[model samples]
Target: MKRIRMIIAAAFLLIVAPLVFSCDTTEKKVPYFIINVKLDQLTYPVSSTNKLYAVFFVNFNWTTPWLNLSSSRLQIITPPLNIGDFPLFFIVFYDADNSGTLNSGDIFQGWDGVIVSGNNLTPIIVPETEMMLLNVDLDNNGIVP
Candidate 1:
């Protein structure tokens, strides 16, 4: 009976060893985009209450979360993206009423057909990383839509 129990234990170890040891150790590579916005402070001064916000869109189908803009030079980092080229549209707005959406008193700036590719997600140079630089002056260059 002891010999039979030893054989059963050996068989159990043989069956479970591979399953316990072999695990998927590969890390997932998540792609992200970055945008550096340069605000023109002379025309539209940065105030405490009235804040700036940015949103990215693709054909009005997909939109990213609202990124708060604080300083004259602001960097926006996107979430993970799938592997493909996307024609992205960017909007930087001044929230006068502190509401998230666009309203009557709000001023905005937008750029269309900004193509970004996901293939070169990981770049070598940090300063020369894949990013878009936007110069925004809400008072002078604000768009209605």
Candidate 2:
């Protein structure tokens, strides 16, 4: 009788194991924010080759920035980004660079400090605005002429 009970228990476990360990088959969709930046009014510098790029300042003044993309003459549309664990915010930099270094530029339009989350999203709009520029001479010696 003891041997018969053990066999029965083993067979029952084998039948129930797969059901207990089964996982959901559905894939979850991630939420994202839509950022719209209009750049029709920007003034191209004299030396500018008219090259423009768009910068994403992830998480509100984060010291490290995300990848910047080449911008059209009119606007930039961002891909969906998953929300971070901490406070969520974003800024867009409409970048105009004449110095060849895409980062160092003579004109910048900064759209700063936007809290992005929740279902009722308002398309974050960044209108054209003249922003402070950083002129960087990466290879120039410390001596100033």
Candidate 3:
């Protein structure tokens, strides 16, 4: 069968390629990464006035290779930030007045958390994903700027 033949060939490549390449002792040096965060598309805005104040936010767990033995913590961030070493990332897109600081006025927001591996993935292959946050404000107090 054609399918059977294809499977056998795939198995052969999988088995043989590693053996061929594994013999090389040279270590590979992988560079760090750069990321961009953005926000949009959420129905919950405390008020139209405050919705204008929201801004995007991000948090990333950074390591020099996630495989490294030591552990670390997540670093929250916004756009225009350059990250180095082994950067594992998650994105938060927010909407609130000032856009600089999250306040009582932020009515609606969107969020998505995904991991970005610096060593395993490359800049070209990395895609910037957007976030949509929930509207947590029940009272209408967020209207102030």
Candidate 4:
């Protein structure tokens, strides 16, 4: 009788232990809001001092109204620049009221001007919101797309 009881208890513990340990009741997938950003011009030269512009459209269908759209950050990725090179600037626009026009105050500006003598350029995000126009001066004289 003692042997039979021991076997049953072991079997019960083996089955219950796995069930208790493997159960996950947490929520996994959190839906993210999608925003589409496009460049005004499709192409740019390798080395030039041309003005680059981009437009961003925020799709609020999946996003809640409580979410802060204006406070979100913007980023740009570029290659490493040579010594004493000028940084690239980015202008971001947001239509918070769903208006068809992007007004003067609707613009967000940022720049990446760090001179790193390497092959890869790190991504930089502008922390300021006052500047809207990005003036990118490629020091390498290479046309950047």
Candidate 5:
């Protein structure tokens, strides 16, 4: 009778141990921002070869990976931004030369005075509800204007 009671207690412990021990306790913290892009007024004819990319400047600079320009609406997820109010000169361009660098004849536009305020409290957030309209019709002139 004692042996049977011991076996039942061991079985209960085995089942409950995994349930309590398998819970995830450690969470990695990463903060980021999302920018929704609107290209409705883009006059340049985008094609499969034309890849889209974005870059922003604060005290330094940050860039996004080249994205396929497959739709009029797009999203750019920024890398982890530390706490600060960074004034951004946001530029989005098509890599028309396919050289993986900004050059002349690549159609693009920019938004000046865009501010990205980042904090460590949240993992992801959108800074604004209005989509950034791309219609300025700027291009790389191989010289700073």
Candidate 6:
């Protein structure tokens, strides 16, 4: 009788052990912000000009405060100007959720048209309120506002 009782107890533990260990304990998604920026247009001179015009759109994601709960720094880059005025490239920086979706109220605007004699790249920072409208070509698809 004792042997049978011991076998039954062992079988019960084998089944319950896996169930207890398989329980998952993970963290949930918290509130956060995301910055979405898009270039709108680029106008350059036909002659040897070092200056160009850029238009862009900046959207913000300020619904909640989760990760990176602070103001972020923005950076913009463009192709090297050889002769005539040309458009440049631009991108923003911010923390994203696990699903790779940028939050609301986190967008910002920027411009990239400061010419330097050397091979130095200059980034222009736009004010938060004034950044609502951007003027630049981001995807290089020739789209403007």
| Most accurate candidate by TM-score | 1
Candidate no. 2 TM-score: 0.39
Please give the RMSD of candidate 4 to the true structure.
15.9
Please report, in order, the local distance difference test score of every candidate based on alpha carbons.
Answer: 0.52, 0.40, 0.33, 0.33, 0.47, 0.32
Superposed by TM-score, candidate 1 places the C-alpha of residue 37 at a distance from the truth, in angstroms, of 3.9
- Residue 99 displacement in candidate 6 (angstroms): 30
Model 1 C-alpha lDDT per residue in residues 64-136, reported as the tens digit of each score: 5334434223545556544344444556666666665656666765643222222111221223234434444
TM-score of each: 0.45, 0.39, 0.22, 0.26, 0.39, 0.26
- For candidate 5, list the clashing residue pairs, or say none: none
- Give the residue spans of candidate 2 off by over 4 A: 1-22, 30-34, 40-52, 57-59, 79-89, 99-145
The TM-score that candidate 6 achieves is 0.26
Could you tell me how far off, in angstroms, the CA of residue 100 lies in candidate 2 after the best superposition?
Answer: 7.3
Candidates 5 and 6 compared by TM-score, better number? 5
Worst 10 residues of 2 by lDDT: 136-145
Between candidates 3 and 5, the lDDT winner: 5
| lDDT at 36, model 2 | 46
Clashes of each: 0, 0, 10, 7, 0, 19
Quote the lDDT for 57 in model 6.
22
Instruction: Give candidate 6's total backbone clashes.
Output: 19
Clashing pairs in 3: 44-108, 46-107, 53-96, 53-97, 54-95, 54-96, 109-133, 110-132, 110-133, 111-132
User: Residue 26 deviation, candidate 5, in Å?
Assistant: 19
TM-score of candidate 3 against the unseen true structure: 0.22
User: Candidate 5, residues 4-57: lDDT per residue as tens digits?
Assistant: 999999999999999999998965443454555544335544444565556554
> Regarding lDDT, does 2 or 4 come out ahead?
2
What is the lDDT, from 0 to 100, of the residue 122 in candidate 2?
21
Write model 6 residue lDDT over 1-145, tens digit each, in one string: 9999999999999999999999876533221122333432242211112212222222222222222212222223322223122222232322222222333422222335322212223333432221234443323332111
